[model samples]
Target: MLSPAGDDILIIMERLGPVQKKILLLFHGIAAIGLSYNPRQQIWILKQIGREWNKINQQALNRAIKSLYESKLIDIKESIDGATKITITQSGKTKSIEFKIDEMNIKKPKI
Candidate 1:
């Protein structure tokens, strides 16, 4: 059960879970590269990214994808090449920037 404002807040948050944030951040990294999608490659990126950064596993991968899609953070569709393509939406991109900018602002140690 949720109130009107609560539902509105959820709409703004897109109901993005923590795992969904990680997933969006991964797509954000890729979007930074100007190649938003690789029909040739797939969630291999997610698995590799999780392993590199957080040791997130396959179930997490699946759930993250599910959440992101449900939240409208990412779009999944077929490319002209007949492969699946996935990309972060503007909403996802903006949120990812918010997520990572703080990461970049961490104070450095004095030499």
Candidate 2:
């Protein structure tokens, strides 16, 4: 019973697989770019995801990070303060763009 846009997003998430989907969802959900700068400086603190996604545990998140890193979907860099920053990579950007396009197309009303 999902809308076309919702279905499109689901398809896109499926293409990215479970772990990447979680990471991407968390990133997009928080409207976050790069790393967070508060108390949990270097850590990948997806507090919302942690609370909302009951099926995903700390170990799952860790594996998702590793998969994203290895696949070049995301990059981890050390800041001047030695804080690790997570950045969406070029491929990730492209995929995001494609997802947006697909979603937009899905949202178009039928004539």
Candidate 3:
């Protein structure tokens, strides 16, 4: 797991469906955000991202999370508070960076 101090994500994007990609990105973002602060509190990145998604396709979010866990790109650890804890693996961060760079490199339409 890349701590809040790290910065990067990549190819995992290619293997993921759009929903999965979105979920992964959200985790990456949250992890980055939390690292800058000293407070150590559990944050549920998966559910937070899932809630931001379209309500009509909620099943898709669930499936995406299941896939991510199965692939070992992210972990959902048990918490004493009974809350979910999501963390992106190093592989996942590398893949997410790949996706972001690819997206940034896209040529814009000549309007």
Candidate 4:
């Protein structure tokens, strides 16, 4: 049996699971890379990292972009082609670095 406080803790823990953290990292990373490119362009660079790691598809890509944009990790501008371009925010850069550090820490083997 779980107390109310325990249930709240469980809910918070469930929200920050491995998969959610990875998705957040990937979305920020992608936004960072996009910001390094032409912002006015109709197309954004779609790297193979997500496919390599998780077999990403169109819907997943859309979801990630939407999530990041809503979180203000990236800014979106519509192009003449009616397509959206992404630019990473300053906060996104900081988050990206933090994510990289977290990845390095996780990948490091126990001594």
Candidate 5:
């Protein structure tokens, strides 16, 4: 059972912008890659995704990350070495799955 605050966060997550959605999916992909190979090798540093995307500008990516963080979708942590790590929360995983399902299509056959 989710609290009212959690529900509110979920609503905010559902209304994420295109850049935010892409970031969520990127985090999802990183998790999937971890499971597929060595989990330890799947860490994503902050700004790395933006650099790899090569399309979304840095400011936009930063804004999306901040939004996602506020929505409680992703957790950002900084180590003593000052390396920032981004990990998707369970809520984020659910949202990413929703995005994938929303993109899936089934074609009907005309007999």
Candidate 6:
């Protein structure tokens, strides 16, 4: 059973486009792998995300990132090396919880 928090996240996610959802979930996955947003690792991280979204164009990715940034769901920083570091904000973390809730499979007991 989903708690109120889980329900709330789902409602929020419904308003986001597919690219935005994937980006949010991708950040969550990156964190799960213990990877920090290092300038040197930015390309690798983006490459991985690109592989998962082979059908998505670069322009779409950029637009989605821009929208997420404008929404304050993520923070983007530019490193001296010109690489952008993206971090999920607290609101983004709350939104990302929808991934876990969606993955849960609760079965009903047969009477």
The lDDT leader among the candidates is 6
Clash totals, every prediction: 0, 0, 11, 0, 0, 0
lDDT of 1: 0.67
The count of backbone overlaps in candidate 3 is 11
- TM-scores, all models, native as reference: 0.57, 0.49, 0.60, 0.48, 0.68, 0.64
lDDT of 1 at 55: 57
Q: Give the residue spans of candidate 3 off by over 4 A.
A: 1-12, 35-56, 101-103, 108-111
Q: What is the lDDT of every predicted structure here?
A: 0.67, 0.63, 0.67, 0.57, 0.77, 0.78
Pairs of residues clashing in candidate 1: none
Clashes of 6: 0
Q: Predictions ranked by TM-score, top down?
A: 5, 6, 3, 1, 2, 4
lDDT at residue 82 of model 3 (Cα atoms): 95
Candidate 5 wrong stretches, greater than 4 Å: 1-10, 37-52, 106-111
Candidate 6 accuracy as TM-score: 0.64
The lDDT, on a scale of 0 to 1, for candidate 6 is 0.78
Off by over 4 Å in 2: 1-16, 32-55, 80-82, 96-111
Winner by lDDT between candidate 6 and candidate 4: 6
Expressed as tens digits, the lDDT of each residue in 8-46 for candidate 4 is 434433434344345556666565665766653413334
Q: What does each candidate score in C-alpha RMSD?
A: 7.7, 10.2, 8.2, 8.7, 5.6, 6.8
Q: What is the lDDT of residue 7 in candidate 2?
A: 64
lDDT of 1 at 63: 84
Residue-by-residue lDDT tens digits, candidate 3, 1-111: 654523322234556887787776776667765664533332454455456554427788889988988877788897998998888887777666656532576578999
State the displacement of the C-alpha of residue 9, model 5, in Å, after optimal TM-score superposition.
6.6
**Candidate 4 lDDT (Cα, whole model)?**
0.57
lDDT of 6 by residue, 1-111 (tens): 657765765666777777887888888867755665566576676677668678667899899889889877899999999998899998888887756544879999999
> Judged by lDDT against the true structure, how good is candidate 3?
0.67
- Displacement of the residue 25 alpha carbon in candidate 5, Å: 0.5
Query: Which stretches of model 1 miss by more than 4 angstroms?
Result: 1-14, 35-54, 79-82, 101-111
